[model samples]
Target: MAEARRPRAIDLYSGIGGWSLGLRLAGIEVVASYERWGPANETNFKNNHHQAQTVDIRRLSFADLPDGIDIVVGSPPCTQFSFSNRGGNGDLEDGLEDIVTFLGIVDHLKPKVWAMENVPRVAPIITKELESGGRLHAFSHLDVQTHILNLEEFGLPQRRRRCVAGNFDMERLRAYASRLERLTLGDVVVALGQDPVCDPLYGLRIPKAQLVDHDPEPALNPEELRINRANKTAHTVYNAMPFPDRMERAVRTITATCTRVSRESIVIAPPETPDCVRRLTIRERASLQGFPITFQFYGATYAQKLRMVGNAVPPAFTYLMGHVFQGTDAEALPPLASHAEHLTAPAPPAVLTPPDRPGSVFPPTRSFRFAIQSLQLKSGVRFELRNRFADGQTEWSVDFYFGTSKNIIALQMDHALRTRLVMAIPARLRREVETALAGVSTYVEAADIENMQRVWTHKGVGGTRPFMLLDELDQAGKGLVEVLQSEPEVSRAVVDAAITARFGDDRPAVGLAKLGRNAPVIAAGLLIGSAANGALRTHHLRTTGRSPKTKSH
Candidate 1:
């Protein structure tokens, strides 16, 4: 009798082969994979002998794949569907493009069965009626069943809930879910701590259980640390924090941005020293995602490693589904008792919502409150940040306020973002700002503006936050002085003198006075208007090349 061949399958968007690893372990041969990211594709090649194609799915053609593949499995990018996105809804265009391409691949292959996985919110989008024949014919009628499976139910540690769509039998998969034992983050931590055995076949560097993906975060003061310990929760920073994951249970979904320290990043303190909390290592994160101990991730930096791990589907969960898909018998396996019940739960409302500390330039009054509360100011606006000397090595950092409609906002500026904001200004203004900033020795990184924007939404408000540009000469820095000198009758000294004398004061005045010209009374009427009722009311405007408009009385 001739030996039977293993069933063939193709994996798309195969980040680190998480989905394919499971199927391969379940007796399926994943011959090829389609991945656009270079580091992730390298990981796939290392784990499985997948001839991964480094082509964008949108541009991939049917001729690019192998013949007679039985199944097509992929988990398209789900960032756009994630809840972490600001305002809870991400841009649909990016997610839709990947989803369409994945479907197109399936349509091109016309595999016996195809499975697509994404965030639960994406279920409707995937199940919506999509035309076939041109790209993916399997989605022509959109008859595929959508299964909302929590990875925890399949015995993988994570509590991630993903929407899986496929033509395969769901009951068969559900039957096998009970056959696996419950896993947790503790198990993953323990497994990763074990020393790697030397493999004679492939001599890869066996990294120890040391911490990775750690960034240089500002250390908390002793008092702050004490407070955090007493509270036993993630500390608040920059008004936003990530929801910390409980170690006893499966972690929340790992995100690609976890490489950078965030409030939501999982923090663990060793049993001996519970005071020191640190982000999880890349290897540990991979283990939490159910990659085997022997599995190795190759990347030049922690960022690449984190991105691969965060985006990968847990292999253990995938393996169970793959086993069921391959018609494996659901023989009852011994159930392991879960120990998570004994672990004490953390305090509710994960983010610590403490009131913002008082700002130097702006007070904590209702007027200032409305400034920060308004959602109208878009991200990436530049503000002139000033650090004025206070007491003994302490300086008060203040954001320059800009008026918008009825609200006022102080622009936040970080070193890296400030450089980009200055550079991005109009060519003539940029030259003047740069000339005035010549003596300042801070580093300039025009390229890092986007990265800074990802973390902190506000910074140097160049033209973006233009509430009182050139209004008061004292408020204008040397850079602003140079830029404003272009206006008629405006000079550096003239601006200084006007600011000093407080002439043409726009703010509300407390008292009124009468004045005459040439020592002769031109008009006997007293100046009745207060500064609040001055004609020069603050004007608020966006940088969309439109004139500023003052609110009506």
Candidate 2:
């Protein structure tokens, strides 16, 4: 019998080779890692012994990739979708382009298996687009699965909930995931000998006047200092002011934003001396992120190094995921080390401390329906999006949470309600409506938050959880562009058909006079009309090579 061939794979956005290393250890041959960051690329090369390509992925052709690739894994930049950046569901910025490029590569390569790891918020957007049967219809054949996972559940130290979307048997994988022993921050910290030590300043209680001289709480605002002294608020760091990693429970998510200069994000108070808190060292952060001590990071600044570590999917999680993906027996895997036998739980974040709110409840000034309708003005349909407050408290502040809600009306052409509206509009007004809707949607989506402070509180807000719906749209648009660019004849045919059916060949400029200030309404109508019947469907059919009647999995 012939020896079984090692499964070949590639890792895109392979920061420090976290996924590559994990997969390779699980017997998958990770042939190449495509990374644009120079320092991370260097680390990937040094550790993984694979050459890292620094090219823009959008320009990469199928031919540029290695042959016989059985799997493709990517963790596209999650900055725009991350809640920490500018609250959750901010502008797509450059992350949208990256998503487009990633989808293009997947479509172009047609890998036997693929997985995309992103923050949990992005799960819905990814699933929506994949199921939309739009440009991504080509991927409809695979048995797609979406796993909403928290790393702490997998026996890692930090608490990070992420979405793993791919073509795999996730049900079975989830079952396997449930059996892993839970690891706490204390266990790994103790195992690595990161012992707590009393600070030299522990005995000294400096007055507020002398706080500047002591500088123990340099990052605290004047108000925060007042709160610290009066309310005994914990020394704060980052906007979230993460509590020190407790031995018993998991630490909050580690962000790429953790830096020496901006050392407020990942604070750890020594278990022995709670007041002697300090920033987590590189090794501690790496360990918290599940990087083996042997894996070295090479970077010019502490920021760069932290970025690599924070961006990585924990290797322990990846290895386990890879094993499941390859159908390896869960019981046969080596037992994970549990330092619980030897370690004690440390103190968790103070944010987790119970609040002492006055025992009174105020009746709502507005109902959910009324509040939702208030946003549904002629300007644009608005809704109260759900979001977390600065202290990690769940809240529904109208001013702070506008754009993140999936319920907000963005002009969807295929939506049944919108389709009827589009049909009612005269053919002459259809083009104008389409243009106006695009413009209005843009304006509404970009509307200013009435109260910025209410939206960006420190304690209630956490880092982003990967909501990338705009990025999905951008990806779909790119896929459509690719279809048009690749086949000019088909593009022309589709365009002609759209123009003739929608407008009766009446030039687009003809309706400009009537559109005037009503551009938004007309645009909204046109958006629906165009979506219901357009050249996009032609491109989708060609791209997927499936009949309209064929069901997408």
Candidate 3:
């Protein structure tokens, strides 16, 4: 008997042909793609070398497709089922209606295999539909298998967990599943060009750095100038903020709002070039979403690229699935030796530190309360700080876990106001928190000692806390007076004054700040400050020259 040829696939609801791309990579022939969106259809046509029909999936009949489609795959519009949708109501019934109509076509065509991908929340509904339609039993006729998979397992950098149900033989899929490689953000970013730093593999483009209003300039106010001078050298310090463990095998799901401001936040780090934005480009977004670099989109705007990336299935994941359906052992397939050259060092081990001492973690019980209440009110960390009284003494401590490692700051307080730190970390995240703290320096600043002591003295509060006070540490011990002088805000006199105040004549700050003049310190300071404060309300650190009667400093 002769060996069987690879199966043919038809992609329905194909937006820019992600499913088709994966199928093609796996050696499956994509005969046609059906899409409702015009731009997506055009882009699909451009990339696949086949014209995609701009027809609605609901109106699509089996007759519209060519014969001999061994497999059918699609990811229907999930807006109606998404929790983000206004309470997930309105047109939901219609969405289900569309799904049924789609399934009806699948049934009519009788493709040997069919797969549908969607948010995991839709699993119950899909399962119910399959049972009702006897599709589960139908799989036996074609030796079909189905599963809901997490894309992270297939080496995507983002944490996209989706449900994938298909009719394929289980034995066939297991063969390839074992050999699947794990993908990381670093793996994809490294493949980009050396100068522009755009990932060629995924067609991600880095936009030229525009001089936005937020760029380094003169401080808006005198106080800002002072702070900008003080922290001028802080701007070029990459990875100064703490990050989660870099070598962990698992990748956190990348959300629509994902950015790399804090250690907990995952960001795509382009080259240390000047003409790059901090966020991931459209092509990088697609790569992270699992689309290959060769995939070209025709949309004019970056938003279109984002839509195509967000809407499409990761090609790597789909290719793995396709291989499984074909009874091929993809994992056993020889690894691409070329890809091995890109692999970097594994992530380092995480460091664990103790929490603050009672009352010493906060300046005072009242200050601890204010800080906790402020964080809670800010809607960022949502941690609760509480003061507990035991044996006529007050105990103050923090009671929540922050999601990002970079956001962790050393707290100081008076010793008498010592209270225990209570962290309400969920069981699932305990290990991740532990891993992130490993190898990271957690020190308490002299300014924050009083506040930290107050929170650590009390009982019924204990959690993993990094002891490093990052801000107080002297990193690359160079001053910023020279850097301040170039700042748009600081006058030459102001820079000279700052330098004299710090070091009589050496002007360490000025000298160091001058190292990267094009990348001004003041601008970096403003960005860091605004990001930390969650807004740009404060920029300058001005003060009146005359001393007030009540002033102690």
Candidate 4:
């Protein structure tokens, strides 16, 4: 009998080799990696991956890629599409460039399997691009799937809601994630046996804040203290972020940065000194992110190290994903803990205590259609573009609600409930919250709120079960708020594209933009022009030997 061959793979935007590490653990050989900003520090991709290349993907040759590659995985930068940076209003062009660039690599490699991780907001954009004869028509022939998934549901011990899209098995992903015991912030603490103060990684090599033997919370300057003071408004609907982030449940998502004032910051006071607390140490942050204790990040500075850790996809996550890609049964593999006894989750951020509101009608929930998703993803039942165009419904209007988690939940109200919902708010918390919003004033009107698909949390189907969670509703929302937040800019970009196409027509330029927000017909038409297949298309063809499909094709 012959021996089975190990699958070969490559990673794009391979920050510190998160995808590579995970894949290698799953019996896949990560033969090559591409990252733009490879810090000169020793603990980077060059040390970990078999062939880490700092050369930009745009500059690489098809000959540069490893041969016989079977799997491809990458977490393209999410900053441009994330809500935290600018309320999901970052540079769409730059963000789209990275996405298209990633697709370009996939096109050239034409690997057997691939997947991408990004904020939930990016799902629609990619889905729209992959539609029949869409902008990224290259891989439309393959069975690609996109879904907004919570990583915690996959047993990674983090309450990270991300969009996982690719040709990977949806059933296997679901089954593998749940196979391991669901862990919590406390479980992570258990995994990281020693405190940062005692760890070898934390000694004189890291930041002073991380090395402090003083009481946990670092001494804050006066301004930060003023901003962080505890508060209680009769109108306060949110459950307070616990002093030390909770350890029982999965932690909140960590990003490339952290701060004292941000709600997402993980503040923790050691059990012995629970009175005062401090933000997570670099090593602690890495553990929470699912890196083993032995994983040495060779960055020169703590802040730099923090960025590397925060930006990585947990190797544990990729392990399960790799199993599906390689046709391996994840259940037969060892648990995530077996990788390194030092493994720990970014201990969860909050001690959840979901609260109630006065509506008697329904409670809020950040579970689905968060401020951005709710604005964009709206519907349990869907309607086609033609159907929507023919409906003759008036322009959409803005509205608000609190989620069960107390995070602001933006809802696109119906016409009939416009006045009622607005009038009802003064009695609840919206009066104050409305002002907190960046001065939004549009109103949805005349649609029957009672008949909308999102049955209020208080009720379930035929009252048979509590509608505590709406999985499908995750696909809905993003009506007026999304437009209001992204437009003017999006409109301006479209307008700019139109101008370039018209004025530069003689100079070999055409207007094409990928706003990801449902572009206007005229704008969409412009997008379907020559530019979609121009530079990106040429790059794909030059790198790979195949001519990719464009909208014109």
Q: Candidate 4 residues 1-553, lDDT tens each?
A: 9988989888888888778878877778888788887662224453454777787766677787777878888888889988888766899767877777777777777888899888898999887877776666666765667889887776666788888888888887777765666767666554344444222211112222432212223533333332243211011233345545676677778777765645566765555455655566555666567655556665655557668888888776787888888776666856654544332222222122121111234333311121222322222111111001112221111223222332332222222222332333323343432342212211111122222222334444322111211111212222223333434444444434444433356422211222234343222222211221232234334444555332211
TM-score per prediction, in order, is 0.55, 0.53, 0.51, 0.56
For residues 1-553, could you state the per-residue lDDT of candidate 1 as single tens digits? 9988888898988878988877876778998988888878877876676688787877877776899898889988888877777745798767788877777677677787788888888776655534443333455654567888888887777788899988877887788776766666666655445455221111222445322332223334342333233223312112322233455677766676742234445656544345655556665666677765456566666566667778888877777667656776677321212211211212221122222222223222211001111111222111222112212111112233333424433323223334433433456554654543432221111112112211222332332111121111112243343344353222322222222233235531321111111001100000001111121111111112232232111
Instruction: Tell me the deviation in Å of residue 177 in model 4.
Output: 2.9
TM-score of 1: 0.55
Backbone collision tally, model 2: 26
| TM-score, predicted candidate 4 vs. hidden true structure | 0.56
Model 3, 102-180: lDDT tens digits are: 5666777788778887777677666554563543434334423346566765556666878776666655655554565
Evaluate all candidate structures by whole-model CA lDDT and list the values in order. Answer: 0.50, 0.52, 0.46, 0.52
Residue 259 in model 4: lDDT = 59
Q: Who wins the TM-score comparison?
A: 4
lDDT per residue (tens digit) for residues 1-553 in model 2: 9999988888998888888877866778888989888878877777677768886776777788888888888898888888777767667546656666666777667778788888886776666656665444456555556778888877677888998888866765666666776666666545444222211101122222311111122233433222233221221111223344355777778787743223235555546456554555555677678765545677665557667888888877777767766887766664333211211112221112111221223222211111121122232222222232323222222210111234322222322333444454456554554554454334323332222222233223322211121222223333333323444443343333333444465635432333333333233223323332233234334444543342110
| TM-score-best of 3 and 4 | 4
Q: Judged by TM-score relative to the true structure, which candidate is superior, 2 or 3?
A: 2
Model 3, residue 100: distance off in Å is: 1.0
Residue 122 CA error for candidate 4 (Å)? 1.2
Number of the candidate with higher lDDT, 1 or 2: 2
Q: Please, what's the RMSD in Å of model 4?
A: 20.9
